[model samples]
Target: FGKSANKFLQKCGVKNEPPAVKIAELLVKSSREVWESVGRDTENYKFILQKLADDFNNIEENPDLITRMKAEPILLGVSEGKKYDLDSVENIYINDDVVYLEIYNELSMIPKGYSKFLYECLGCKSLSESIKEKVEVSGNTQETKESQDLQKKLDERAYLFYCDYPKNFIRRNEGWLKKLKVKGIDKIEAKYFMKAKNNYKIRPVTACILEDQEKCIFNFYITLKPDYLDISKCLVMYIYKSRKSREINYLAMMLKAPLEDLKYSNNDANQENSQCGVDKTEYDPQIDQNSTNYDSQLEDLFKSLRTMFEDCDHDYIYHCLKQQEEDKLINVENHLMEGNYPKIKIPVNPYDPPVTIKVGKTFMNVIQISQPSLGSYLNENQTIYCKNIKDYSLKFEKFLDGIEFHIPKDIDKSEIFSRHQNSLNHFAKIIKDLIEVFDCAPKFIRIFYDKSNLMAFNQDRALFFNFKIYLDLYKIEPTIDAMTYWYMVICHELAHKFVNDHNSEHEVSIS
Candidate 1:
């Protein structure tokens, strides 16, 4: 035997030197700590046997294919708060320590087309079967019932390995978790409920981790739907084990960090990096289409902005006006020194429209009065600006009555159309929620243009207002910090609709 084979046998606690194949079997059965000892010594073992072992163990406990089969009806039953047909549940005993539930239609109940997708999408490991066959090849010619049962268990494990191992492996290397955090930029919490045609709803637990230290974010999602007996168990599992389930556990191993320690890794580095003004061209949406992982990307962008404006904080609207002032002052000083435009200086009015406002330039829209007045100049501009009005629709009736405003000409229609798709994607779920609550849909939602100090216009409009997030703020922090801007915009705009009714007055203080 070779030196690696001898070391493998010693690490596995086998006497003498096992054959090359036997050594491989022992290595497959060994724990990571044991395998690491051998792995450190030589690269003879190509496959990650320890990971495969984990894959097998994970399948034995939570066979994803089986779990998915069970999940469908259970999700339906729980959503309806009724009993699932017992025929859909199956209990299979593979061996002493490997008992798993297989979900399938009863003899009378025919399997549906969707079942195929579920089955295919779930576990499908075959390598473990080869490993098992290799291990038991010497004496398994009898084909007894016990042997058949063992074979069945091994097959099940193999299928599961096929299903989860690749995903687990990809997630570890490609930074899937990191991507999730980016997807959920402005959303603090999100609930993913999948509804089948039959009104069966599956509540999937999702967590988007922004692991800055690891330069990755983990967007973890899992749905477990077990019938009556397992419903409580599912809930219990979610509470105690779901976060640390095999999927996440394997992911943790790949990250080289424990689940608990991994919390700090969440997007803080991305957030901080974004705040640092190192590079802006890197995450430009026009240049990189794959940059649409909004959550982490936005966070990074805002972090970049924070880095640019040392006095400002992550929350965009809260400190935007101050930052804008500082920016204008810097520009004025530059102009004065270079003699580019000695006459041009920072505006005395913080929210005044710029003399040379363009469609894409960034600017802030501030109603300068100390307090927003319903009857004063605030309401006058609305009538002057909006020329085409047949009758006030219920959507903007109250808002129109409260405000008079003129839309800025600098707002670009093309830019609005271009950015609108993503902004709509950002708030689609929230819009759906509102639609459900109100029981009505508007004819259209219009996104306004960019100003000199802020990329977009006033976010106060009928039923909704749209605006652009300043690129400068994003340039500083990059991706993670950019998310703060999106959230602030959403919160500020939504507040108008949510805080009080049309006639009711609330303080509209803009800092």
Candidate 2:
């Protein structure tokens, strides 16, 4: 029957077959020899092998080590009857290729390969496989999926020991099995071993990514070896959690959606978040328009200038002028165009001979050497030759010079096609109120375009004050006596300077 079975096995194309029965006997014999070499008792040694097999079987079925007693075999080995057991086996020689064991009142030998198989049967294989699986799992989703596939292959390998090994064949290789002693596991130190793996530290949310419109959030878990506890796990966890919470907060704000709106999965949350932003755009046409405006070519320039005057910290007029000088239409000019103050044509009087007025300690002389040679009134000529912008400006300057040179009492202050100082006084009072309220003083103050309604401050010795002048151009009126009645207009400019100076000094001190 045996010969017929062998012929049938050959006919079925059995290939590369090894002697399994002989290998099993060799494994058992070698295990006994190695154990007895250290003077392990016959009965106790047998019991340990059986217990190890049972452990392997249990691991194969359930694979949970939480309730397992790691101390059981160790306590048994060190008890009164088992005292000589470890001591006796202390010097048992196990070389790279062979393990020596004592069994049935005799020493026996087994090859290293069979010993390695025995080690697997003794539960070290399960532990080794578990550790390997944990190591292979990178915790990165992309890599983890690949690892899971590899885990299936490992499971098939595991089936070799549990199902494929012959029924009566138990591998017992003491050398390889004894070598599988990680510090905590082999020594049975609960504190050290308890932290061997951090499966417990994993929260359910660790596997999920919570996201809103602004950010994607994920729970992070770290498991570290004893050596890297400080820098790797503990420290990393603290920093990671703080950063994640901030990200989530910012995301909630950006989405205009509550945290509860975020889905547990990041992909779902991201899709929903995108939809939320779209919905917001749809709700407010103005917001969408603003967004488009923000993306325009002049974005940076517009933003800087659009900030409130209070928001501008440093008085950067000189800085802006310097930028303008360096590259004609570069940084500062870009800002100028963006700010809608593109051209600054310096104001010159229309009807004055060019006169240099030097500012001195007290009252200064506004000397006008010449006036319009063509006379103040053209009786019959309905058409006047304005000629060009330059000549037109010259005439305008002459007219202003004539006004400045005349004293307040000497000039026909009321009858010169103008309203009296009544409205100017009210406007001046308003200027004083604003100045006092804001608490700022400017060095040089002026009312431009015969309009005392608008005031200008020279914050720095630069041409950039034109921007401020442009800003208030619409609010001002073209009136001749505008400055005469509004003395507080000067105070308003002074107030601007005071506020700007305080801010500039504060920023400098801080830096």
Candidate 3:
């Protein structure tokens, strides 16, 4: 209904009418590109394609969905050396006419208006009296019995979908094709795998039922043991139809693309937008907490820095943070010129300890960085500066070897001691085990209360070779799933110590 739709319709020369037979022509052309030539008797196939297009138009469905389904490699059967993939093995159209007709009707992704046209193409009479006369004329013949059996099978076949097809077919999986690589930031490919439990039992449920595009009935997860599936690995199962009995009777599964690819792409996008920066110095960790002088663009800079740090695109974020420092210097210069503030140069050595500076009678702690590293630095720096570690960990008896758990001074320790003691102990054990396994060398791991998500890593890792990690103590509750998830996040950050971006090197390090 927009430019993409309009352009497709224009190419088909059907802006004022249903796509009709042109849809079949497009399919035949596309099929030639992927498989051997199909639909030699194109005129004979016209009735079904025309009818399908008219049915979709009559139902007011977007023409794109039906057209896309027809063009994709959907049919599969045991035929040649390439065994199950019809889209890849050449010469699949051995009996072009029969297979062409079968393509329009015998599909799990069959267009809503297609079967009736297929019925007509089979030369069934349109009206009841005409049908009765035809049945009588062909009564009890072998051909009639065969046709009747075919009709019964068609009626009994199930049509299950497994994707939320975006408009113009964006991110739509090429049906049955094993994904060779990971792609798409908005959604994933390899549509039909279900989420599995420890036992890997599966049940199909309708997921993503868009009114006109597609429906994903993801009720099964045919995977190996749950232990084999790592959360950090981002496992996906690719399920496809195998033509064994009639056609598309048996389903086969293969594992494909990891979800870490999504995070990598997301970080790439963030770098493009914020142009990447990092703090080359440590700060007081509390300077910008209650400050209201920051504008929206500056706020975006802080947000970008946080996201990039989390994403592990360190170099790009370092440049962005450097720009932030330069802006602060310009402001400081203007203030000193107006006699509103004393001139002072904050050290940028990055190894310098935080020192107090006076501004308008306010003695605020500032990390003399390349002059600024601000609030986001503290938010993720892992040291909550809470003097309450010994008091809060009264209930956490299992002491970590290389980790110090701290509750930010702001959180009510008494409530945490009473309510979240079990949770703290549960997550603390996970951290301890992960550290032992990965040889993690962080000085302290802080559990602080944040709004939604949590992160780790000190703003300045150079100081005492001290890397710190922060966990959102109250972000997610103490559950098996939550523990598994945080374990992956923690491992991911630790992996950054070896390699930052999720590349082959990072993958190997994580592995």
TM-score of each: 0.18, 0.15, 0.20
lDDT by residue (387-466, candidate 2, tens digit) is 11122111111122112111123344444325523433333333333323223232112222322211232322210011
Tell me the deviation in Å of residue 319 in model 3: 65
Clash count, one per candidate: 68, 27, 15
CA deviation > 4 Å runs, candidate 2: 1-221, 224-245, 248-270, 276-305, 308-511
What is the lDDT ranking, best to worst? 3, 1, 2
Best by TM-score: 3
The per-residue C-alpha lDDT of model 2 at residue 132 equals: 15
Reference-based lDDT, residue 141, model 1 = 21
**Candidate number with greatest lDDT:** 3
Model 3, 48-128: lDDT tens digits are 343443343332354554444444542222332323333311112212111122322221221211222222222222111
Candidate 1, residue 267: how far the Cα is off, in Å: 74
What TM-score number comes out for model 1?
0.18
Worst 10 residues of 1 by lDDT: 92-101
Per-residue lDDT for 323-426 in model 1, tens only? 22335334423323442211211113212233532332111221111221111111223211111122222222211212221235544445544655454343
